[model samples]
Target: MQLTIWSALILYFCVFLAGLVDSAAGGGGLISLPAYLFTGLNTHTAIGCNKFSAACGTGFSAMRFFKNGALDWKIAFISAICSFISSFIGIKIAFKINPEVLKTVLIIILPVVAAALLLKKNFGVENRVEEISKAKAFRFAAYTGLAVGFYDGLMGPGTGTIAIIVFSACMKYDLKTASGNAKILNLASNYASLIVAVLNGSVIYRIAIPAAICGIMGNYLGAGLALKKGAAFIRPIMVIVICLLFAKLFYDLFARYFLGG
Candidate 1:
């Protein structure tokens, strides 16, 4: 589909916002997926195009985190490998499933996660010592990769948030480190999904190219802010993203099941 000037401009703005939020906290797909759908693409095509822009943004953020030495290469690498494989499988399954079913599941799940974060005041605020051995951390990281990566590929939203939540809560990493490491694994998941999208001819490059450029800029800026401000800056945005995800999922459910829009 060809993009008019107004559509292209709107997409740029939306993707930029997504990149910023995704880089700082996660759930950037909440913005980008809806924006793509508004362009009249079907769910699969919209998801494919979204992965293109989101992956670009995530790549930029991961680079910044790597440069700062905030990422644990050992964990990130293992997680990334697991994420790639799980994401590929998830995308394959997504091709056969109705997205409404996924939205229904998220509606039930996201609020609980948001509530948990809200109730735990000290969560991800500071770096915590590893509560388990290296072998255990590696095992936990692998599990996180498979679970969150599969979710990312199938639903294309809130995967990064899940990663951060697991990394900090289960792996005992600090928020900064968790966020940074999440970017790396998130990139892997996005790339894995993107490959499937490309093979299935779901992406529209005309829209994706400009949106990706805008997304890259936003990621760069957001990652910079997170690095400078630490968890204090990231935590609030994470909360906001979670709330937004919940709201978006609720709307999708209501529209499809009731309003039928």
Candidate 2:
């Protein structure tokens, strides 16, 4: 597809915003996916291209969070390695399934995700002692990695938010720690998908590089604010963004498949 100067520039502008939302919460794909679709790319190419672009921004955010001592590398490394393996399997499975099945499922998924977000305030930012054993913790980490990573490669919605929610609810991680760790795992899953995108040549480097720069800047800004204001601020944003993302997903599916507009 040929790109007009205006279209290219504007799309990159949107990617920057996507990165900001991604760093602060999750589901940034809500923005970047539509931008790629507007370029007339097919679903596969659009998703692959988005993975390539957003992975860079996610990496920057993960690094920032790590530097600030917000992450638990013990868990992050375990989950990341497992996630990478699971995502590879997931992409392959996605190729066989009807994409609309996933879309319809998401219509059912969003409202629940939204409700979960609403209840997130009860989760709290304070750290809790691990009630599970080391063996059990490692087991949970691996399962979460595989499940979420598969979702990342296959559908790419609510990945970060899901990770944070699990970290808190299951692992007893506080909100800030969960967000920080989730960003790292999110980077891993995005990178897993990007490898395939690069192989298939769906990504345009010209668009990706500038957008990545903007995304990195946004991460810096968002992470700075997250660090300052604490999870109380980030938590509300996570809930709202997830709800918005769910609505966007529902609308996209409804228009393309149901309304046929």
Candidate 3:
């Protein structure tokens, strides 16, 4: 797409916000993808560019988490490896299945998840990793990675947010730690998708490069805030991301099943 200066500014601004939200919680694609489509790029090109920027932004936040000692290296690596492999299988499955089925399921599930988070006041406030056996934690991480990664490849939205929820709820980590862990998982899937986008010659480097710079800045700052504020800061953002994902899914289902768009 040939972007005018105004369109470029708007895209960059949106990407910066996406990086901020994604680094703190997840679901930044809800913002970044729409921004790209609004700029008149086709769906494929928009996805390619968004992946390029998101991968770069996520890398910076992951590094920050590592440096801050918020990440469990063993769990992160295990999940990353599992997700990396399983995503290929998920992609294969996507070709044969109707994505609308998954979307409908998510539409029902998201609200329940959000309500649980809201009602359980102390949901992710405290890190309780010590209560769990190491073996059990690792096993759960692997399972989470496989399931979430597959969902990512199949439906391609809200993957990161789902990862965070699984890490916090199932593994009993604080929200901050869960957010940290989610970054590694996101990085694995993002780069995997990015490579395919590149091979297809879909990425527009002229646009992606500048947007990536903005994304990096946003991620850096957002990660800093999450590191400083802990679970209290991350929890609300996670809820917001979940709501955004719910809205997006509902819209897609409506457009396809009802509007015939």
lDDT of 2 at 173: 78
Count of clashing residue pairs in every prediction: 0, 0, 0
Query: How well does candidate 2 score on lDDT at residue 162?
Result: 79
Model 3 Cα lDDT, one tens digit per residue, 1-261: 579999999999999999998999888999999999999999889999999999999999999999999988889888988888777778779879889898999999999999998899998888899999999998998998888878877777788889988998888988889989999998888887788789999899999999999999999999999999987888788889999999998898797767777
Better structure of 1 and 2 per lDDT: 1
Sorted on lDDT, highest at the top, how do the candidates line up? 3, 1, 2
- Let me know the TM-score candidate 2 reaches against the reference structure: 0.90
TM-score computed on alpha carbons, candidate 1: 0.92
> Candidate 2 regions off by >4 Å?
99-106, 256-261
Name the candidate, 2 or 3, with the larger lDDT value.
3
Q: Arrange candidates by TM-score, descending.
A: 3, 1, 2
Error of 1 at 81 (Å): 0.5
TM, every model: 0.92, 0.90, 0.97
Model 2: which residue pairs collide?
none
